[model samples]
Target: MKTLAIVGAGPGLGLSLAKTFGQHDFRVALIARNQEKLDTYMQQLREMHVEAAGFSADVLHTAQLEAALARVKETFGPVDVLEYSPTPSITDVASVLDVAPENAQFQFDYIVRGALAGVRAVLPDMLAKGDGGLIFTMGGASITPTPMMGNVGIAMAGLRNYVSNLHEVLKPKGIYAGTMSVMGWFKNTDETPARIAASIYEMYEQREQGEHVFEV
Candidate 1:
């Protein structure tokens, strides 16, 4: 079975993604910083009858992230799909970010470079085979710039640019690259995760390359 590796896997959209692809026979690989959390996610996928495994690695470290992907490939075979969902380390994230602009680098490291590591780990093989899929969970700060999100918005903006560039360059090379830009209130829209997951699957099915925007 093909493998789908979800970096920064967590409870909400991550679990929805796991279920959506796992139910369709994709070997789900849960990648996260917490092994215990990964274990829980693994159990949940197993309960749902999905072949799944847990992996732990700090996304900020490219070497560690690449190593984790290598291990996944060794165990489950080449990753057919890569889902990157990065979270900022800063808890009290605010719109006015110049107060501690340095924090923005952390976001860039995890969100942008972290994603690059995953892509580099799998791109060669995909290039050789001439097909691949890359999906990103993005924020509203990317498409619409707000002064309040200056810190994270900087990194998010970079991520958005990279996603667009990658789509332009690699789509013709058979890599399906896109972003799920969440601009809505996820808490109020409980079903948004499922909808996003389904939309991701549809994008892959159609080999679509572009931004898939949603409020959730």
Candidate 2:
């Protein structure tokens, strides 16, 4: 079975994504900073008859993140699909006026550089195989500027722009790269995690769209 590695796997969307892909016969590698939570998620997926494993790593630390992906690859073979959606630390978010250089740098490292590191870890193998999927998740501020989310917006926008370009560049190689931008609160009725995961699964299967904005 193909492998799907979720870099920022959590209890909600992460678990849903695991089920969506696992149900489709994809082995899941859940990556997060908390081992206990990861274990819990892995157990839940297994109970549902989904093949899943967990890896502990903090996105902000390149070594840790790369190591986690390395373990995923070692366990599940080259990752056929990589989904990156790490949530930035609260301290990284700053208002427009209060966005100091340090805060901006932290956000950039967390959102942009961290993603690059994750991609680099598995991309070489994907390139050699001539087929793979890359999916990134970000808030609405990434595409639509929100002053209240200054530093985060700046960082996420950078990632969004990069993913857009990556989509075009990787197309010819039979690789797919896309971004999912969430607009409004996901807690609302129209934006449940399971629903969003289904939409993402469709995008992965179709591989025609470069970006999808989940709006409620």
Candidate 3:
């Protein structure tokens, strides 16, 4: 079976993606900062009969992330799909002025640095295999650039462009890279976990070389 590595596993997107891919028969490796949460998620996946393994590491720690990726590869083989869905927010709705400089730095670190680290951690293996897919979750703030979410918006913009460039660089080698911009909040949508999973499954199934953006 193909393997999928999902970074930043959480309830909203992480677990959703895991469940989605697992249902489609992919051996999934879930990475999160909290061991308790990872264990719980693993249990839930087990109940569904999805092949899964959990790793705990702060994405900010590059060495930890690298080790986790290595473990995943050892267990499930080189990752065929990597989903980066980091939650980059200190306060839910802090104005530009209200957000502390440190908080802004954290957002940038989590969004930009985290994604970069993940790409670095997995790309070498993917490139060697000459086949893989990297999907990043993007928010509406990237295009709209809300003042209240300036830090996040700016970071997303940077990440989106970076992934675009990766797509161009990796396309010739049979690797597909892209972002899936949700465009709005997923919490209130009728798009259930299964539906989201189907969308991702279709994307990977139909992935073409040089494709960069997928606005879902």
Most accurate candidate by TM-score = 2
Candidate 3 overall Cα lDDT vs. reference?
Answer: 0.78
Task: Please identify which of the two predictions, 1 or 2, would achieve the higher TM-score against the true structure.
Answer: 2
TM-score of predicted structure 2: 0.96
Identify the superior model by lDDT, candidate 1 or candidate 2: 2
lDDT of each residue in 32-51, candidate 3, tens digit only = 89888899989999999999
Worst 10 residues of 2 by lDDT: 184-193
The alpha-carbon deviation from the true structure for residue 84 of candidate 2, after best TM-score superposition, in angstroms, is 0.4
Candidate 3 residues lying further than 4 Å off, grouped into runs, are 90-94, 97-101, 188-193, 209-216
Decreasing TM-score order of the candidates: 2, 1, 3
Compare candidates 1 and 3 on lDDT and give the better one.
1
User: How far is 71's C-alpha from truth in model 2 (Å)?
Assistant: 0.7
Better of 1 and 3 by TM-score: 1
| lDDT, residue 142, candidate 3 | 66
Clashes of each: 4, 0, 0
